[model samples]
Target chain A: MIETTVFAMQVLLLVMGCLFFAVGTLGLFRFSDTLSRIHALTKVDNLGLGFIVLALLPLAPSLAGGLKTVLIWAAALAASATSAHLIARAVHVRPEPPEAKESADD
Target chain B: MTLILNAVAAFLLLTLLIALIRIWRGPAPADRMLASQLFGTTGVALLLLLAHAQAMPALMDVALTLAVLSVLAIVAFVTRVVRIDRPSSGRKAGDQPETHHD
Candidate 1:
């Protein structure tokens, strides 16, 4: 019974994570603006990943393996955030048409 | 159970691919930044799923650190943009209304 229960939980987590990931991907294509897209991606992405992590936590073979996974997650987040910021900054500084530009450009 | 986890990981990878598309086609730097953020999120999700399947705990700590750092990066970017866009005090001497109206 205990084994079955654990298996069930794992399945549940997998489904939930997939759903959120799908939503995040859809948002990437659907949003009209960068800011809006970011908002959508962040919401779904964070929860999706978190759920997946929680689900897998039980299966970790050893403490070392678990810690390694967490470290990888941290590194991924750092890279993503920094790259995004740099790209956004570049966009903000470039010369562009008035209509396509942010109000702050004035 | 392993199959289910594998499927989830695959889906997350797909999400990452979509985000890459966005980054490639992004009209502006901001758009690219948004796409990159998506990548980060998906990457974390993938790592977590993998760890779970492998039964690893250390990966969770990494995910937590990533979450915090990503948020900080966003905040920093916003502040930097705001500072850059701030209006300068360059009022023309003539534009300063003539005080001789008295």
Candidate 2:
């Protein structure tokens, strides 16, 4: 019974992670602005990868291996947050009209 | 378990494809940069999933490298593209108050 329970949990977590990733990508299409798109990608993808990392921990071959996996997740979070901030600051310092924007009137 | 992991990885790949669309149709450079960041995150996640699915621990190391270095690309973009508007001599015009020459 416990094995089946764990299996179900893993499936659910993985599925949830994938869904979050999809939503993050969808934000790129739906949001009209760069900052908003960064907001979606950073925040949502962080959660998505975190879930996947958590799901994989139980399957790790050793304690060190598990910690390594977590480290990957932490590193990714840092990279995402830092890059997002840099991009947003760059945009703020010099706002540019998008090169191929569509008319808002329609 | 392997099957489930493969399916999840495939879905993440789909997400990656959608993000690629944004990069390709970028209305702005920042938009493309943000999409590239998304790609980096997705790549790391896919690497992790691959490690588990294939029982190859070394893939985690590749993921680590990817996660750590992905930000460098954006930093380069910011320094190179965003700051190109002005001279790179470490000063912007009118940044200091003018004083009469003696």
C-alpha positional error of residue A14 in candidate 2 after TM-score superposition, expressed in Å: 0.3
Q: Which tens-of-lDDT digit does each residue in B38-79 have in candidate 1?
A: 646776677566655565646556655655565565556544
Query: How well is each residue in B33-70 modelled by candidate 2, as lDDT tens digits?
Result: 77658756899999999998988888999999888778
Candidate 2's error at A100, in angstroms?
13
Off by over 4 Å in 2: A97-106, B84-102
Place model 1 in a CAPRI quality band: acceptable
lDDT of each: 0.63, 0.82
Q: In terms of DockQ, which candidate is strongest?
A: 2
Docking class of 2: acceptable
Candidate 1 scores an iRMS of 5.7
TM-score of chain A of 1: 0.73
By lDDT, who's the top model here?
2
